[model samples]
Target chain A: MRYAAIEQWSRQQSVLHRRDARAKIGALLAFLIAVSTTAPASRIAFAGYALLLAAAIAAARLPFPALVRRAALVLPVAAGFALVLWFSDERARAVALLEKSFLSAVATLLLVATTPMPELLRALEILHLPRLLVLVIHFLYRYLFVISGQARRMRLAASSRGRLQFRSAAGALAVLFARSWERASGIYRAMLARGFSGQFPALAPPRWRAADAAFFIAAVLASVAVRVAL
Target chain B: MPVIRVRGLRYRYPDGAQALDGVDFDLEPGECVAVLGANGSGKTTFVLHLNGLLEGEGSIEICGLGLKKQNLAQIRSKIGLVFQDSDEQLFMPTLLEDVAFGPMNLGMPREQAVARAQKALELVGMGALLHKAPYHLSSGEKRRAAIAGVLAMEPEILVLDEPTTSLDPPGQRELADLLRALPQAKLLVTHDVFFARALASRAVFFDRGRIAAEGTVEEIVARFNWTQR
Candidate 1:
């Protein structure tokens, strides 16, 4: 029953955690756009963005090291492209690419870490995301656990007999895919049986209060100000 | 009148496999029936047709309404089919939401759906775990949550596929007790003879897409030597 540590962080009590998911999402979008558009040569702008995340992290009462570590996962891929830029004599752009990617990941992590996935998805739906797309996300999140757990069990069952080999592994992978497909169909049938007619109904949608709007507006203005001033 | 009436039900897979052939069945109000069969004997397929999930050549009348394309939704709302795998049935983020999913889909107001879901969860002894994710539940809890999800719809008939698949003995006993307390007419598609004996007043044995025998649980079990030797 162990879930991702971030999922646990999301349930913790904090002011940021209490905000409407729509507001956090809006603020996240503002932060990403602002960071993406800022000049690569503006080191101070990058610092401003980083500082903003730092303050938000402290305010949310999340562990700073854990947030940074999770966000750092984006760096290895960014570093590959950054290496190409570095060798082509675009060193500042390379650094900027790395910085921007990391910052964006941090901002996204902040939003998800503060809001539960269901809340985030509801916000996405309310913001006019396609119903089909939202449903896909919904099933993907729910069944990813089911499929992966099956894979783990299959792997154990295979390896326990001391029959592990490249050929057998490939065969097991194929079986996993087949089983997953079968399970997906069964899940679909179950959904239909329960009267699913396209829309994934929200049980209790988060209320958008004046405070949420104020937080959203403040987040956007701060990001814009940093992008402009720097 | 029977809560469920089926006549001449037949279904063939696209691969030319006849899953069900010329099946006839009836489930009366407040009665419980067990469908005993081998893995490929079409027990699941036959139950699927009851909820209109699988189309086949058949006449199905659920709670006095004929099964048809236009009547599919209403027919579905009248029968709750709990799948063999609890994972398949409970897909929402939280237990409450998952339970409420059916009521909401039935076009009930959000508050009413939630209230119904809560009541259903309480009935299944899962009210305390409303906020828990399905993945976090033990298999027994997941099964209960799945039943709660179906029960929230207030279906007149309950069809459970292998309800004892992964349950321990105590869990099985607890489930049987819980199910016995519910008033819905029941159809259990299972291989567990004891479970069948515990819940069903009558039984049907399916073999290669046909009901080979129908009688009391002991009668069906003895006729086929179905009990574990």
Candidate 2:
């Protein structure tokens, strides 16, 4: 459901959403690299990176509170590593680890929140990402909705009949897996019936305009400036 | 001329169950044929062979082109097979992209493909839902979108498997009307007798992987007691 909400957000019209996926992807990469490479002692650089991401989220018109909450999901995982660093007596590194990972997650979320999945995947394909990897991501995203629906239905059926015990839950999971396998095969056959060879036919590839170039260059330069100066 | 021709088609599952045995069939251009049978009687398998989706020991020709590895892309473009599960067929991020998929595959320009997709969606009465995700659609809307996805390809023949499975009466009626308006040769595999009578002039019954009988829709339905009592 969270992904569904994000998917809907991606379709909304906005200045950031109108930019080509390539520019957003490039900007995301610059932001992540800048956030990750900044020194633990330079708290000002971290603040600068966070400010840039906040500006992007605002420009994209996403709900600030919700986006911030979702980005915090990375904090728990990062805190595990941060705790280790703290016990090992690396106090500054512990705090910086949480800051860097959270910022990276927020920056990555901005890219997905603005660009539709299809366009983002197309951008990855154009950047020479392996075709197989792109295909996997495409199918995974598409089928996640279906598989989750099946799980939800099974849960409802179980609840209607009686409480779901562990044994029954395990059985339901097995059935879900089998059903998903059958569904996947059916989808593959449908794809073949529609003339899908190994690769999806590229929809009209988006043309890279001068504006897209300008956006990418500005993003990269700004990220580099903050990393080097702040 | 026959838009589809098949001869000596035989297929066996990996478990050795014979799904089709020497099945021969044909679809004259602009003819609508209903394939009627009980579950697992080879109706779906026969349709699958038409587009080279399932390779069986048989020969299939679509619009005068032989069904082979080299001719498969062309043959598929000529025969649009809509699966029973609309959920499986509509996999693109949005309805528009899913509908445009076939045209884009055939190497049509993006603008042309999008235009064709939009036209097809309009034909199916889903013009306004182009940006909607497939999961968000009602069952009937999903079915219409799936049909639009195939129609966008402009196939000469349309093959639908168990099309009325999840549809209510109104959805079935709407689909029947849409199918009636299409000019392409149609091969419908369904158990819905009233639906068949509404659209199909002729009918073929499959029993145990072979064509048990073929005749006018009334004759086939009566001979097999196919209608709901």
Per-candidate clashes come to 0, 0
lDDT of 2 at A230: 97
Candidate 2 per-residue lDDT, tens place, B51-146, comes to 887899978888999888999999889899999999999998778989999998888888999999999999999999987877789889999999
Model 1 ranges with Cα > 4 A deviation: A163-167, A209-211
What lDDT would candidate 1 get against the real structure? 0.93
TM-score of each: 0.94, 0.91
Clashes counted in candidate 1 amount to 0
- Candidate 1, residues A1-230, lDDT tens digits: the string is 55778888988989899999999999999999999999999999999999999999999999999899999999999999999999999999999999999999999999999998888888899999998898888888877888888898997898889978999889988999999999999888899999998877897767989989999999999999999998
lDDT of 2 by residue, A1-230 (tens): 33477888888888899999999999889888888889998999998988888888888999998998999999999999999999999999999999999999888888888998889998999999999999899899988998998888899899999999999899999999999999999999998889887757666677898888998999999899999999
Q: Compared with the real two-chain complex, what DockQ does model 2 have?
A: 0.63
Candidate with the greatest TM-score versus the true structure: 1
Q: What lDDT does the true structure give each of the candidates? A: 0.93, 0.91
lDDT of 2 at A75: 97
